[model samples]
Target chain A: MAVASARSRGRLEHPRRLWVVGVIIVAAIGFLLAKGLGSSINYFETVNQAVALRSSLGTTTFRMEGVVVRGTVHQTSRGTDFSMRSHGVTVPVVNTSSPPQLFAPGRAVVVVGHFARGTDKFLSNEIMVKHSANYVAAHPNRVKPGANGSS
Target chain B: MIITRRQARRPLTSSSSRRPGSLVRTATGVVGLASVAATVWLGLWVTPPSTNLGQLVRLLYIHPPVAWVAYLAFGVTAAASLLYLWRRTRSVVWDRLAAASGEVGVLFCGLTLVSGSIWGKATWGVWWTWDARLTSTALLFVLYLGYLALRRVPSDPGTRAKRSAVAAILAFADVPISYLSVYWWKTLHQTGTVLNPQRQVHVHGLMAWTLLLGFCAFTLVYAWLVAHRYAVEALAERQQGEGLARALAERRAEGRAA
Candidate 1:
């Protein structure tokens, strides 16, 4: 009688084991989908988007992308001060962190920081350069020092 | 019967029968190595630096080519898996080819991520990011790795091949998603230079030629790797079959003596 009951229990456990495994796999996939999609939906906001949502954002740290306007870069005691423009909207940025080697005027960059309290200036601690796909060979005579307008 | 069987196996194991195929594989390996060297030399010394990116643009020659090879390897795996699944075209050859291509694809995919990370650090100022393009590519690498792991689960050949073929097909669904992620979402990673949807060419002159050469060279290396991997798989399968036969014969002989 014990042997019969044990055999029946073993058979019962087989399908249950499969069910448990299936549920675990489904749950893992669901979690990954949610996490991956949720984070990537808004990887970074453009300068226009950031400005439009500034009030609701309320000084929270986030990444913002824009092109560095030419002739607006200034090196200050605190950090580099510049104007980031996108879609005709320009936002003044004060980045405390040192910018990358490629960071210069007319280059696209993503700055990681937030808006200063009660001020229009964006306070950034990190600057990342974003280069385009265009690749043109440099002419020997045309390549000049500080041609990229780095501060 | 045992002596006769052993004699028959001896010829199959001999090198003479495989001489022609071995010669072709050797030649392919040699050419692939030569082209890779030429690409390195041209990329480093001959090709002029870009006006904007300067010397940093040299990484373009390797990164794009490695990424292209990864895509090609997965594409072949998908095609071979489909052949294995189709009733009219089903064969063990297709299954082996799919497995070989998948392993090679994983290797190239890893190279892609590493090379891309280095390039990103220099240009984007970040070693890694969770943007759509980067995330989807990382997912692809993990998915194929899972597929390879699934193949190792102990099972009979027919059942294993069928399940692995299904898994290969499922994993291949991510390739297109990864390729088009930049277009589908606003990504930190830049879009394709040569294969963009706009049909525009961002590279020019000697740089263009070197990039093309890199592609051809890496592709040849991929072919050589897959060929060697498939040969090894075939040899392993043959040895397994021989072992099974030997064990079965021994059991029958004991039964006869009893």
Candidate 2:
């Protein structure tokens, strides 16, 4: 009789355990969907988009993408100052953070910050280099310094 | 009704007929290793540095191939799970295959994250980011991990296999979403090079060939791993069944003596 009762209890608990696992899996999926899709959909805005929305986006932190205009990069005491251009619109950016090793003129970059108050210059705290999927062999003479001199 | 220990051990013994399967597995492993070595030699020495990415482009040979293998592994898991769920095709072999592939998928997914992180740090200037592609891929890694954990929960074989098969299929929904995340949203990670929707070949010459070799190498490795893992799963299940039978025999013997 005791063995029969224990087996019955075990059978009853089995479905309950599965129910708990089901609830947990559902909850985890919902959390991941909310976290992944909610805030990161618009990772960064283009220079033209940010410029068009400048009035409404005043001083709000956001990320903007544009190519660093040639001959516009300058190292200052605080950081680097450069102008980025996209869609024929240019925005001067004063980045207070050190740029990445790959940061260079004519390279596309995404800067994280906002427009400075009372000035047209964008204040950036971070810079990220962006490269396309296209891969071309570097010319013998055009190879950048310190790039595995074997090439 | 008495059973000897030798009878229990009989199920665990391998017959000589299985030699061909072992030979095939060994051949697959050897070819996989040889190709991986070739990829390393070519990727490091032969392929010229890209004008834009410089020497960092070498990471392309490692990251994308492993990422592709991860996708392939999960795809196999989903297909096997579907087979297990279908009444006509339902069998323990499918369940074992699904579990084996899912485990291997997690390993490759982890390698994907590590290799991608290293590449990101050098090229993107950050070790990590919460962009759409990165986040979705991370979610995928975690989802498979959850599937593996659910498979471990104690239950009767049939119940455990059924539930885990369902979980495997559901977890596979994340694989396509992760792959398409770059197109579905603006992301920091670059778009696909070879498998892009445009089908344009961004890679060329020796560089392209090296990348192709890397894909084939990693795929062979994944196949070899799944094959070995499935054999181990089969052996373990047989051992468990034999142990249960022995325990039941002992109980009956005690009842008869009493």
* Top-DockQ structure, candidate number: 2
lDDT by residue for model 2 over B129-243, one digit each (tens)? 7788887887888788788777766667788788999988988988888899889888888889788889997786899999999999999999999999999888877666666
Highest lDDT model number: 2
lDDT of each: 0.83, 0.86
In order, what fnat does every candidate score? 0.41, 0.47
Q: Residue A76, candidate 2: how far off, in angstroms?
A: 1.1
Alpha-carbon deviation at B168 in model 2, angstroms: 1.6
Q: Global lDDT for candidate 2?
A: 0.86
Off-target runs (Cα >4 Å) in candidate 2 are A1-31, A142-151, B1-18, B253-258
Report residue A71 deviation for candidate 1 (angstroms).
Answer: 2.6
Q: Provide the TM-score of chain A alone for each candidate, in the order shown.
A: 0.71, 0.74
Interface RMSD of each: 9.0, 7.1
Residue range A14-100, candidate 2, lDDT tens digits: 656756765776677677678787756888899999999999999999999998887999999999999999999999999999999
